[model samples]
Target: MKTLYDVQQLLKKFGIYVYVGKRIWDIEVMALELDHLYKAKIISNKEFVSAKLVLTHEHKIEELKIKKLNNGGGL
Candidate 1:
């Protein structure tokens, strides 16, 4: 997927929805679910890798946002 939203949409297509009251946690859950789907052959390696990349990128961004906030910087 090109973006986190795209990854979320892909997961939704598989009837997977995850929310843990935190964006980073949600992304991590999505990544784990994607891993399961990949292992089950429900998604191709390319699709899994793409979605994982998006999720990783989003997770990093969220972490940076949190760090910024903790450092007294506004997002």
Candidate 2:
């Protein structure tokens, strides 16, 4: 997937919807679910790798945001 929305749509195709109140947590949960799907051979390696790239990018962004906020860098 290219964006977080694409990853979410991919999960939705399998009847999975994740909303953990926080974006970072939601992304983390989605990653776990994606792993399960891959392990079950429900998703191909390409899909798994693409989804992971998106999730990892999004997760890093979220972490940076959190860190900046904690450091009083205020957006």
Candidate 3:
């Protein structure tokens, strides 16, 4: 997860392919483009909402569960 390639591969496994730029600054531009497309009705509201929920809830829950497991030390 240290590199963009790692993130791309992880996302691809979930059927998402993000065209990330070489530099970190490009992520904002890409996000803006995505917002514009959604605003123009190119992307559905369902897709946007689902993506937001997955990024927020799914990832956080998984990370927290893992942390709890590790801290419990095989409990």
Identify the leading candidate in terms of TM-score: 2
Off by over 4 Å in 1: none
lDDT (10s digit) by residue, model 3, range 1-75: 343344345445546555554333334433454465568876677654544444444445656776787897586
* Tens digit of per-residue lDDT, candidate 1, span 1-75: 699889989999999999899999999999999999999999999999899888888999999999999997954
- The better candidate by lDDT, 2 or 3, is 2
Note the residue pairs that clash in candidate 1: none
Give the TM-score comparing model 1 with the true structure, all chains together: 0.90
Candidate 2 stretches with Cα past 4 Å from truth are none
Off by over 4 Å in 3: 1-41
Backbone clash count for every predicted candidate, in the order shown: 0, 0, 0
How well is each residue in 2-68 modelled by candidate 2, as lDDT tens digits? 9999999999999999998999999999999999999999999999999999999999999999999
Ranking by TM-score: 2, 1, 3
